[model samples]
Target: MRPVRVRTVAAAVAGLALLSGCGSAGGLESTGEAPSAVGPARLWPDLPPASAAPYDYGEGETARIPGITVPGDDVHRLDPVTVAQAGLKARTKRDSGLDELPDATVRQIRDCRTAPGDCPVLTPYYFDLTGDGRDELVIGVRLPERQLAVRAYRADEGVLTRIMSTVDAVISVELAGRDLVLRAPSVISGYEYRTAWSWDDRQQAMLATRDEILRVPERRGERTAPTPTAPAPEGSRPAPSETPTA
Candidate 1:
């Protein structure tokens, strides 16, 4: 898929501001001066292995776990752990299952897509399965005629394998005790309200629609006055004063 071209100027500016503060005395001098003593260089902390052994989900046709709905276009199985190992950050819309896939597999998937020209180069939506601190990859696709495909993957056997029923734009994904729900409007005109779905078992799948009424939160009190700005730091340059012309 091709990359999306949205510019995140605000985010870039915020990052620059943070970097600018790093060299400032106030930022680096947070800790008081230490006693004059020489110390040996500290050893780097021992860290866990970068990658885990590829997970294995027994070879066979992917079975449909009860309450899960698999999408037709999802071509492969993926292991979630492998996705994380490949340097894809977790829990954001752009974390595609690409890292989980073999290079050839990813290229093939990209080429096979209809209107691959319009597909996003980066995957959007970071999905966490099991919620044991690792995140799975999610890929979304828009077909030519208003159809949407959402696929999830976990790493297995050095390859990404798809989880059962982990596909669809509108799906009810399970989250620990709390059900991660998805709602979509029905195609029929009379059914204007959206239909809801939830995951059934620990595995991913969209279950039957369930009606749940939620109370909207009430508005809070009126707005308060803006706070005053802090004065510039001591020894910092002040704003330039205007000079009168003769």
Candidate 2:
């Protein structure tokens, strides 16, 4: 089989820091006086702490992929369609509730080899999200009603382990540094939701470290309608524009 081309985060990081100018230039130079540091103030300190978390973003939720093994510890050698199929199978075995993968999507995965054009499995991208100097497979699967499933897998001891998984009605997925940035439309007008998933070494999983709602510029001659978001299979509703919690 021909080698699959993969993009590396090491290269991306190197390119970004090539001219960062972090090193000293012969001597220490002070541009201006440093500003005074202001520590955070305690507000409502008498209030009792909440018993439970406000939201569950599925952090630290990871699983070892069944019926799949990495060949030569290379993630690129694995078939994207097969990986997606395994994920769907795993979802079915769990109590997914209303967040289950549609039957149509299951059929498409089986037909991907013969009907590549109609396959829901998108072209996979590789990145070193774990900072281990090895590329992990990043894939996106199209679901019904314009929703999408994004997942990432790593080769651990020759076994394929899924490190990150999430579903959303995504507008776009971007690789920013070592974080997987997801952009999705919000129900609120003139605003959009952004979530950034970063690798947590201590947790051994990707966590939603940053979530925000930002105002977007309206386009000319276009009416802004509320875009409804699909519920994630993990039983947590996607954050709306009003809630900026991670």
User: What TM-score goes with each of the models?
Assistant: 0.31, 0.66
Candidate 1 per-residue lDDT over residues 1-246, each given as its tens digit = 223323466667777678667855734334577789988875665756547436432211122222222243222333222332332222322234322434443443455456555433334445454343445455544433333434445433233444422223342333333233544335553232323333334434334335543433334664456999998888796766698556
* lDDT (C-alpha, whole model) for all candidates: 0.40, 0.82
What's model 1's overall lDDT? 0.40
Shift of residue 58 alpha carbon in model 2, Å: 2.1
Clashes of each: 16, 0
lDDT per residue, candidate 2, 74-94, as tens digits?
A: 998998888887876554223
Angstrom error of the Cα, residue 183, model 1: value is: 3.1
- Model 2: worst 10 consecutive residues (lDDT sum): 91-100
